[model samples]
Target: MTEYGYFLASEDYGPNALVEQAQMAEQAGFTSLWISDHYHPWNDVQGHSPFVWSVIGALSRATTLHVETAVTCPTVRIHPAVIAQAAATSGILLGGRFRLGVGSGEALNEHIFGDAWPRTAVRHEMLEEAVEIIRRLMTGDEVSHQGRHYTVENARLYDVPDEPVPIDVAGAGPAATELAARIGDGFITMSPDREAVDRFRHSGGGRQQGQASAHGGMKVCYDTDRDAAVRAVHQRWPNMFLPGELGQLLPTPRHFEQAAQLVTEQQVADSPIPCGDDEEEHIRSARAYVDAGFDVVLINQIGPDMRGFFDFYRTKVLPRLAR
Candidate 1:
């Protein structure tokens, strides 16, 4: 069955605010939560980046909804062994309703240690190795790996969950998608691209036990005033409209701000993200993912009116989607 969830943007919200939003999402009928893991916001306007693991710990106590790191870059910025420990602790904290979503990583988060940013092929390789290390550690046994990208010595997680924590790999392109198929327990992508989902399922994915989940995430603005919503998105999330590898190549929020200046309000207005309180539009946007074979659709509100967004989804959008 397709389930709808709330996506919590760490770049745009503080930890407490995100937890409150999670509680409200549960009250509003959202069955799961997707939280972004980041070291910096895309721009100063989107200004906040709380450590995601800390927020997950708080979320474990705050809500019963399933929680996932919309995508964490386990390949860099942190070693995979440490990530395994974090994931294990998080799984126990969330009472097993936790999934570690990993990706190849962007320079914005991974380049902080003055390391040379790797090319796409190398990043994917590193990500595959990282996932392997994480899975091995989560087995509650000693792991000593000396791979090309990372090295771990005598590392083992003492507090693994009763069941191994699932790692869902994120993919935005063909090569990454295939890697996700081979290495991921589930798949994560930010679009309603049916072809990508098919590629994942047909290319060795969904063969373990049963069909693995295909999770799709998107951003929307829910407001009474359509123009106002567009302007808000233009101001806060212009980075959303950035093209090609720019999102992955940029090293800092300042660079993102500079690049985002090229994005105009008209671009955001024309993008697929549903804005305003048009119930049918929001319903249609989410339904696109379901039609594309997503098992879960995670939606993030890009504006300030989260409570209003929750109320709107609770009363109209979700019920209609349910039908």
Candidate 2:
């Protein structure tokens, strides 16, 4: 059976709102939670970016739902050893209900330290090494590593839970999917592209679970009009319209501002922003994820009408799939 969940943009909603959303999600029958970990919103026009780890701590205490970082990049900004510690503490706090979702992060978040971002191949190499370091630390055993990207000396996670915490890799391409299979406990992706999923399985990720995000599955513009929802998504999350450099090192939102200027709203909407008012379209978008071999399908409510979104999914969408 396919599991269902909601994606919470920590930046868009405040912590209190997040708590309410989690409670509402549980009440509405969502099985899990996927929260984004971003240092900055795709565009400043979006107006929010809260530290995700802190929010997760609060969510763990507030809801019964299982939580995962929709994706976090441990290769930069934060050391892998620190990520290991954070995950361990989060696992303990959540009573073993946390999964560490990681990826090779973008430059916008990591470049604050002024370090040059590595190339894609080098980033993957760094991600692989970082995953190994995190896994070792999660075992509660002292770990020391000297790798091409990182080095840790005699580090251990004292707050680790009794059970092992699962690591899900956020991968998009063939090389990344293969890496996920070899190193990740599961897979998380945005597009339900079957070819990528098959490649992941073929590359020995068969045993791994798969999860995906439905970009347009829940644009709850119930309170605001449909036009309002489209404007909100385009203004705040213009990058959703851009497919490249998501996992790469990047400049600020202004960099995207320049790039996004070249693209039209029609082009972005046509691509898959999912902002319009169509229940059938939402279901079809979500079904694409399931057909692509995802075990968990997480829907993100991009617009401001949270209650409307919850109601719409609970009534029109969940009923059809719950069976």
Candidate 3:
């Protein structure tokens, strides 16, 4: 059975709003939650970026839903040792219902410290070392390491969870997917690409040792009026359509906004992302992920109608998917 989850976009909503959305998601029959971990929103129009760790703490108290950072960049912006501590605390707070989803990350968040962004290969190297450090620290044993990317000395987590936190790695291409297969407790990707899933499975990432298999996600806008939804998506999430490495290389929200101006409302309207109250459209959007062999499907709403989105899924979409 595929689990359906709500993706709480930290880039789109503030901490309080995210907590409320988590509550609403649980009531709406969603079984899990995926919250973004970002230091900046993609563009100013989306207009919000709260510290994801703080919000996760609040969520632990507010909702019973299992939570994971849709993906946090442990390679840069923050040291992986610190992220391990944070994830460890989060796991304790959530009573073992937490997953630490991590990735190579974008310059938009990681570049704030003025560290030169690494190339894709180097970033993967750093992430692999970081994941090793995190796992070592999570064992509640003292760790000291000297590596090509990071060095740690006399580091240990005092408040580790009874079971080590599961680490789900996010990937968008072959190199990253292979790394995820080699190191991850699970795999996460935004697209419903069967090839990526196949790559993970064949490249030694199959369900062999209790791996979570593939987890997928997509963004949709729900509104009674289709045109209004298109306009809203163009206004708020045009960054979604910015092609290629622009998304990974953009340094600031302003840069993202400047680039997003090129995306037209029509592009959003024509894309596969569902943007209206049409139940069939929404169902198909989610079904695509399920059909691609994803064990978990996470949905993120692109506009302000979160209440409407949850309600529509609760009363209409969820029932159909359940069948």
Candidate 4:
């Protein structure tokens, strides 16, 4: 069966709110949780970016829902070796219910560390090494390594998970899909592109029983007002609709907001996001990922309507989309 999951957007809510939302999501019949790991929100209007690990700890106590990072950038800001330790403890706290989803990140979060943001090629190189280091550390054995982008001296995860934490590497194209297939336990993507999923599966991704899986994420604004929902997305996530590397090039939320001024409401309306109170529209938007062959699709409800969105999905969307 295709599983449907709720996405916990750390950029849009505080840690406490996220914990509460986790409870709400489980009560509403969502099967899993997907949260983003970021040091900064995409734009100022999105408001919050609490440490995701801390929130995950809180979620561990609050709900039985399995949790996964939508996609974290472990190649920068923090060492992959360190992320390994965190993910290990997270798995233990959640009783082996944790998954780490990683990707090449945006400058909004990575640039704060004062390192020159490397180009895409270098970033991918870093990601490969990072994943290798994480996998070794997850084995609960002492590890040391020196690679093209990182160096690790004697490190190990003391509070290792009973079962290894699955790693999902995010990708957007054929090249990235191939990398995820080679290095990740599963593949993660933001869009519901069947072509990309096909590339990933053919390159040795998708379901393999004991191996790689496919995951996808989507965003929606569940408001009573359609235009108001458009305004919300245009203001908080115009970065989503940017054509190319603008998201990775912009260094801060302020920089993102400045660039987002170029994104019009019409563009936001034209984007493939589910908006307003139409149940069918919301279901249709989410179905794209399922239709693309994703084993699971994580749904994010943008703006300040979390309760309403959850209620609507519980009563309307989820039942209609149940597999």
What stretches of model 2 exceed 4 Å from their correct place? 208-224, 246-249
lDDT of 1 by residue, 72-158 (tens): 998879988889999999999988799999998899999998999999999999999999999999999998999898888998788
In model 1, the runs with Cα more than 4 Å from the true position are: 207-212
Measured by TM-score, how close is model 4 to the native structure?
A: 0.97
**Clash number for each model:** 0, 4, 0, 0
Instruction: Report the Cα lDDT for candidate 3.
Output: 0.92
lDDT of 1 at 205: 80
lDDT of 3 by residue, 1-323 (tens): 88899999999889999999999999999999999999999988778999999999999999999999989999889999999999999999999999999999999999997899999999999999999999999999999999999999999899999999999899999999999999998899999899999999888886635646789988899999999999998998898899998989989999998998789988998999898899999999899988889999999988788889999999999999999
RMSD of each: 1.1, 2.7, 1.0, 1.3
- lDDT agreement of model 4 with the native: 0.88
lDDT of 4 by residue, 142-200 (tens): 99898888889988788899888999999987778899988888999989989988888
lDDT of each: 0.92, 0.77, 0.92, 0.88
Choose 1 or 2, whichever is better by TM-score.
1
In terms of lDDT, which candidate is stronger, 1 or 4? 1
What lDDT is obtained when candidate 2 is compared to the true structure? 0.77
